[model samples]
Target: MITTHPFNDDKLREECGVFGVAGAIDAAAMVALGLHALQHRGQEAAGISSFDGTTFHDHKALGLVAGNFDSEEIMRLLKGEWAIGHVRYATTGETALRNVQPLYAELASGGFAIAHNGNISNAVKLRHDLVRSGSIFQSTSDTETIIHLVATSRYRTLLDKFIDALKQVEGAYSLICLTEMGMIACRDPLGIRPLVMGRIGPEDGGTVIFASETVALDIVGAEFVRSVEPGELVVVSGGEIRSHRPFQQKASRPCIFEHVYFSRPDSIVDGSSVYTVRKAIGGQLAIESPVDVDLVIPVPDSGTPAAIGYAQQSGLPFELGIIRSHYVGRTFIQPGDGVRHLGVKLKHNANRPLVTGKKLVLIDDSIVRGTTSLKIVQMMRDAGAAEVHMRIASPPTMHSCFYGVNTPERSKLLAAQKSIEEMRQFIQADSLAFVSINGLYRALGEASREEEAPRYCDACFTGDYPTPLTDLSEREQPNQLMLLAERVGG
Candidate 1:
């Protein structure tokens, strides 16, 4: 057992939510609760903005919605029939209260609200262009760049300005906007982020909601319609759903990671079960990365479903070797090495009786920086597991993600830094194997025939960004964070 915590482990989620009501009266409170259900997508900050049949009201705070929103206070201020709310995890911006979403802006045409999921890879260039034109920005986020772009457009109507604004920016984004006239939602050409249109009810027959995941829809009692097509824009107003597309439509490339790790199991994604996809990934791992072992042990939580699938497919028995303590909230994860050293142990407890002197096959979703995996492997070994064969359900994460996921530097990525044999030696695993890209897609493809329409964006694997970035005039490469910071703060 290797007892070591490797450097550069950052598990950050960039997923967010956009919930709205066009026809309902108590829209703000409803959006508040809807954002709560979608909180798993992001927990750093929460915000809600609404356009009543008359006036717009907004409130955003720098903590989880549960902590920030005092119901009576927010509800008292938020009075409206139409609303849009957001929960965010910082990916392309500084983590500050000002950077939180459902960004409210007063435009020459009228008032509008915007919430964005995914990253604007070309934001640095766009921000520079805006600044050169005397555009002043209030927040340090890629999402804010779009708002500035829209504000500067020469077009007359908000819709015209918005369409022009979409043309100027590049990269993955699913944007939901609350305009004086209606609610507008658009998915990037690549569809790196997920967005679905939801029908509220038969009673409130005309109401519709837009969200990053179907789970938000389920919570709001909205029926899952279909995903907003890549490079498409849909607007809901006057109880009527309308769409516009000044930009030409491009190939649809949805993010495959949504099924791998992000989404809630119960929420349907483009017509497939998230749980089933995970299980299939596990099943594929067993077939592709087989090993002789006494027990198949999951790393707990995300690894459990895949581990079960692996166990069932491999005809090997599965055991709850690492038990996760659900009671530990984010507050329990203390910062700094003094408490950070307890990252793995505080989250999990090893069942020594099951592993004492056993050869265990450990299943995990993927290794980010080798920190958590190294620590967990050492814990298993310390628990008396003589041999630990590490199996990863996804392929090696080599490239950094610009589509709103908080991945570290490529140099820090263990897979990019070390080969399979090198990683096995580094983690001291008896053997280490990862499921192939083909196996991952194959397993997911086999799970449902209905998901064939929209192909997934595996850019993190293949370096194939579906949308061509046009505004990275200053960005020579993705790793130039220092240069980016200088430009932003200058």
Candidate 2:
């Protein structure tokens, strides 16, 4: 079985991505391209569901989109003009075929298939209640909770039922669902997750597309439309589009980390270029914590843009001191602990000639558990670097994220457990610094994080969650939730 390389596993992971297209011929193929563009968000599994008026067809598998959806035979079977797809990393469910999404269900109204891109924080509690009321679940995915909620709602129309289901749950979600009526796209009220809309040319059947990121729309050659507004439900049917705001209006709190690491640098979120925001973040870091070093070096791909910003701001030459191997397959296997420990070079290696005598400033997006940072610093020292100072582009991640990010428990987060100096010691670096919380807000165009109603969700850094964590709150102890989650999954 393919697994994430150890060198790449010590980071917070976005749970999944969703893509949907309506009114296009050969729509499944377009969905495939969109999902492929979104592959970076989630890499464990992928699935697609399509509707061709009278019938619904789907194919789900435990692998990358290219591996599972590139076959002509599979595409031929997913016959429909309305399609939605998902790539998953298993935030709430087991890594099994049944847990793969674009989860399909045959409801009383018709066939319903949904692709979800965030966690339903109250899923376990809702699931327990649903089971006691005789709702038999087919998979452990929290997404299915929405389906069951819709199925049991007494609302008159499918749209009403869908809205009814959403109102009953809490936490971040950006969803794309396909049904007999047409296609529906919506984001939770807080907008902690992202969803955007786009339109294909008339030549391409004038398709309306929705995806977790603008990058996916770009992949399908779809023109950029506005984002699906928070607390708004958009429906495309009868060759016309309709928008609904079924819930009370509230200020949006989109995820701030999207600019730091989760999103592709090429994508745009909340009308700002992610690449530009990251560069600004790096500049903020340079201003807040100036360092005396010979060269500024980025950890690798994710850190490159920020490093450039830091270089421009601090007037230091940015160098690629660490070269990442592009050909290193995600499925690369290490047979044992000894082999795994030696596998760091399989992904990145220091440029010995460039770093032999230089005092370097290393820039990275964030330090999670600090294992990757520690190893990278050690590797640089082994290459004869005179000094290494680490600068983080974002505020220290001191809290766990429950809004669909796959973060370790708070206890395991390096920043949560250690002070900046302590983290420097743990990573064996000469120095370390992170952008202050207010500095992060400044980078994002806000003067400061408004404590009463912050503009974005920075919960992972501040522990200021916007929604009630029903499942976690119900647990009497920290570990009790893990036990309860296992039981709820059953």
Candidate 3:
């Protein structure tokens, strides 16, 4: 089957899930198969690239990997013992075959393939420098910026080139790369993104796995190894793994949102159950923001379990407040924010009787811009509800996220501009309570990385961005791949 299944909006993003394998036959094919297991993180496009010691072969297309790839295609491109794969959501470039990755780059000695998760903070700066140096480009992706640096760097080895490129780029990234000599996986300095390592067994013919989430490893029968630490690099070749830690920055804080929203429930993100963390948030919301409610209403899909937890904590009945339509493709047009900020009507509608005339505490993952929140509240008000108290399972987003999550400029975020009281008045809600910062950590079962779960980077909530983002307020919107490349690839 070309397409394995479907996903939702919260599930769709510029962030992608990556998978790579070393020391195996048909490694490229295996990586492709593993990516299939992670299609939930991204579905707009898929690609796999392999390095067989002499050359790199890649095949990419704009569709679910299952529908876009077949056994015959895998075999035709399979040539290496090291392979890397990507499933993408366009954050930088337009959705097309050219933008699908793992993107390929040629070199004098050999080539490498790369699949990446996260955004480039200093892409504008880097792309400008590269362009001035006469480094021609292909594909309008932030990732190609890394290649331009690698191609021109005077480093003696590809590994060294990778390190140099890492130094030049700043932002959230978890990278899996395949070269003729080895399989390399690394995460950004702050660990703003996640990349874990796993193994099948040395004695069972020795194999290693690298993926954006541990769930993909578990699906393929691999034992969980430690996560590739922020600013650390690992190279696997010939059934052996070697580690590198050349760059160490400030505190290594992986994105907390991964546990709260981005990751799969089954995957252990830095060793925490994504499901457990969210449920705890729900329970806390109930205690901190309880309402004299007839029922606890969840926003649907992502909020279901939290709603259940809220109901349990508040002694209220839990009900599905909004039903999501599955199979809505990414191609669906999200109504523009200005003309119809209340885009929720297109994606959701209220079941009036369940909530009408009832004192209801409505729960949702978050309120990014508050436009949707305004609409949702209006919907509840229109449904004959006596009161609508909005409780977000996560903290207010006051900062723009450089790691992804489609956050707009800082000013566009309602939380950034308004006080808590102002937000309630603007949204026309009776009340609003967000999960406390410390409480949020506890909900994720806050534990040390060595103990179990790790600390997380909540830059968007705290304004302590893991890395600095270049100011782009003056830059015009980029179209096609060139715009993204020029803006972020430099």
Backbone collision count in every prediction? 0, 0, 8
- Top-down lDDT ranking: 2, 1, 3
- Reference-based TM-score of each model: 0.90, 0.95, 0.85
Q: Model 1, range 227-303, lDDT digits (tens) per residue?
A: 98888899887667887766776766778878877787777776788888888999999998899998999987778
* Better candidate by lDDT, 1 or 3: 1
Off by over 4 Å in 2: 2-5, 202-205, 473-490
lDDT of 1 at 449: 23
Go through the candidates in order and give each one's C-alpha lDDT: 0.80, 0.90, 0.77
All-Cα superposition RMSD per candidate: 5.8, 4.3, 6.5
Spell out the clash pairs found in candidate 2: none
Candidate 2 residue-wise lDDT, 313-378, digit = tens: 999999999999987767876677877877888788999999999999999999999999999999
Q: Estimate candidate 1's alpha-carbon lDDT, on a 0 to 1 scale.
A: 0.80
Better of 2 and 3 by lDDT: 2
lDDT of 1 at 346: 70
Model 1: worst 10 consecutive residues (lDDT sum): 1-10
Pairs of residues clashing in candidate 1:
none
Model 1 clash number = 0
Highest-scoring model, lDDT: 2
| Model 3: number of backbone collisions | 8
